[model samples]
Target: MRVLYTSIFYLLLPFILLRLLWRSIAAPAYAKRWAERFGFFSALTTHKKVVWLHTVSVGEFLAALPLIRRLQADESVQLVITTTTPTGSERVRATLGDSVVHVYAPYDLPDALARFFKRVKPSLYLVMETELWPNTLAACAKRNIPAVLVNGRLSEKSARGYTRFGALTKPMLQHLSCAAIQNSVDAARFVALGLSGDKVIVTGNIKFDLSLSDDLRAQAATLKSQLSNDGKHLVLIAASTHQGEDEIILDAFAQVRASSFAWARGAVLVLVPRHPERFERVGQLCASRGYSVVRRSEHSWNGASDILLCNTMGELMLMFGASDIAFVGGSLVPNGGHNFIEPAAWGLPLISGEHLFNFAEVARLLTDAGALIKVNSAQTLAEAFVRLLENDSLRVEVGNAALRVALENRGALDKTLLVIADYLRKS
Candidate 1:
């Protein structure tokens, strides 16, 4: 079955490459790292004991940062991190530095996977979130490398697809030695899919451990001061926003601007599109809405624009610190939402759509603690924004609650490190 899957993948390789070429026209990183599909082969020759960690994109990379750091600090292991997206690669490079090897994961074709396995020769493989590739898992199993899924989550939406192909999905999941899931719900779902209940442990969401270093916080503060001149009444930042969400946020921003609230009178909106390819589109979207916009990539903000489009990578957390409130994107449009914990870690009051199945546990915790507001539509989002902005006392109350929740969830990294260390020792 794996061989047949690999053959099918190879047969479609040319078209895949062509599509990637088309995407690279807008996102140059795609073209720039075209050969990175075979990166594992090249990396394997240098390190004696390689531990491979796969993260799909920026969010997963951020969630795995502390674990990556811990792995690098271990003298017995050499960490090799793989990410599927350019943003994820950029984040790993920025955060992990020279301590770990960074590469793009190969396609799951047998030849590619075999070459990758032969080169990297990983003793252990750690996959972040729910990125399960049958061929990749099979390759690791064949090599006798213990593969584990860390920070695993199984949503109802994803479970449906898995159940649709239960035969294939069950065996693929069972290949993992263990799955350190994000919550009890995820654990239950994984167990239902034929994984041993004993092999699935609820570790909470690792994203709750996200925090900016003092230097990063200081830099963001400086940038905020430069942009606002310390004069803006409040700043509402919408980070990692998707397509429809951006329009909704813009409408909400306009409403807030027209509102009677005191803080709304001088409030600024910072819009950051989720993908780099859409940065210009987002900037244009803001401009078409008749707002003076400043692009962070091109200009040092001077606080004059109605909105600041943060068209840069690896700075969302810093941006979170500079803002008074945040609306996490990918939620309103049912993309399952991005990490809300980034803002919460900074004690910034947050707003998000009702659909946060991706980080359901974290969302529930924030809602329970009165740390976040859940809005289902544009009007409610505007109301939440205005209410938080106008009432400084309420903002501070929610902010404190958010900070408390973030602090309370800090030990996942430590616990994960213990598990990884044990694995290394046995290996």
Candidate 2:
């Protein structure tokens, strides 16, 4: 089954490259790192042992940073980080700087994985989240390197997809030294998928262990003042929105503004579409709806604008901090919702659509704590916004509940680090 999987992957390589080329039409960075994707790189001579960690994209890369920093503190560890996307590579460079070596993950062809393994010669290999590659894991196993999957999660939808490839997935999972999953549900799924019970541990979600810099908060304060003209406007942020979501959000925003809520006249919605490719489209959508829109890249916000388009990356957290209410996106359209941790950390009254399988546990915890509200349609979303804005005490109550939820969920990073440290010592 593994051999057949690799053969099919090899045959699809050309199509994959063509798809990358197609994506490059919007994001030119996608076409720029062809060599790194092939595992062709200048050799580095280092006496210290190498530790390789791989992530698929920006979200996983950001989630792994806390763990990466913890490992980097060890004198014997030379960290090498690999990401599958150009955006992830750029983020690693921007955040981690020269502290660790960063590279694009090789295409999972056996030859490419072999070249990467030979060049890096990693002492330990770790993969973040759901990025298990058969050839890469097999290469690590062949080299006798301890490979661990940290911060693991298996959504029901993804589990069903993997179940279809049980023959290949079972053996691929068995190659891992450890599978530190997010919760018992994920652990059960992995065990049912044929990973031995002892190899899987429930380590909790490290995303809960988020760190917000004082500088970022200060920036948010400045932005809030500029956007609201010294707290005169009510700020609502709809973040990480998908295609179908933007239309609903805009409609909801219009409904809220026209409603009898007292703050309706002062309301301003910050629309942040998830993908960069849709930033312009979302801005146009807002304009077509007759709302005065301002882009975040302009670094200028006038209280006059009805909508703020957060077209820039790495500023989502700051924008969340500046808002009075947060509506997490990706749920309205069937794309599983994004991380709610950011808005929760800000202690903002949060709202999302019904679908939230991706961050099920976190969403449940928040909803139970009265920090999150789920809406099914544009009317409900508008109602949620108006209700939260109309009552100051209710907003404060929900916000405080959210803050408590975030506070109570602390220490996952410590647990995760301990597990990885123990594995390193035994290895």
| TM-scores of all candidate predictions against the true structure | 0.95, 0.98
User: Could you tell me which residue pairs clash in candidate 1?
Assistant: 44-119
Please list the C-alpha lDDT of all candidates, in the order they appear: 0.84, 0.89
TM-score of 2: 0.98
**Which prediction has the highest lDDT against the true structure?**
2
**Model 1, 382-407: lDDT tens per residue?**
99999998888999999999999999
lDDT for 162 in candidate 2 is: 93
Task: Enumerate residue pairs that collide in model 2.
Answer: none
Q: Who wins the TM-score comparison? A: 2
lDDT for predicted candidate 2 compared with the true structure: 0.89
Worst 10 contiguous positions by lDDT, candidate 2: 418-427
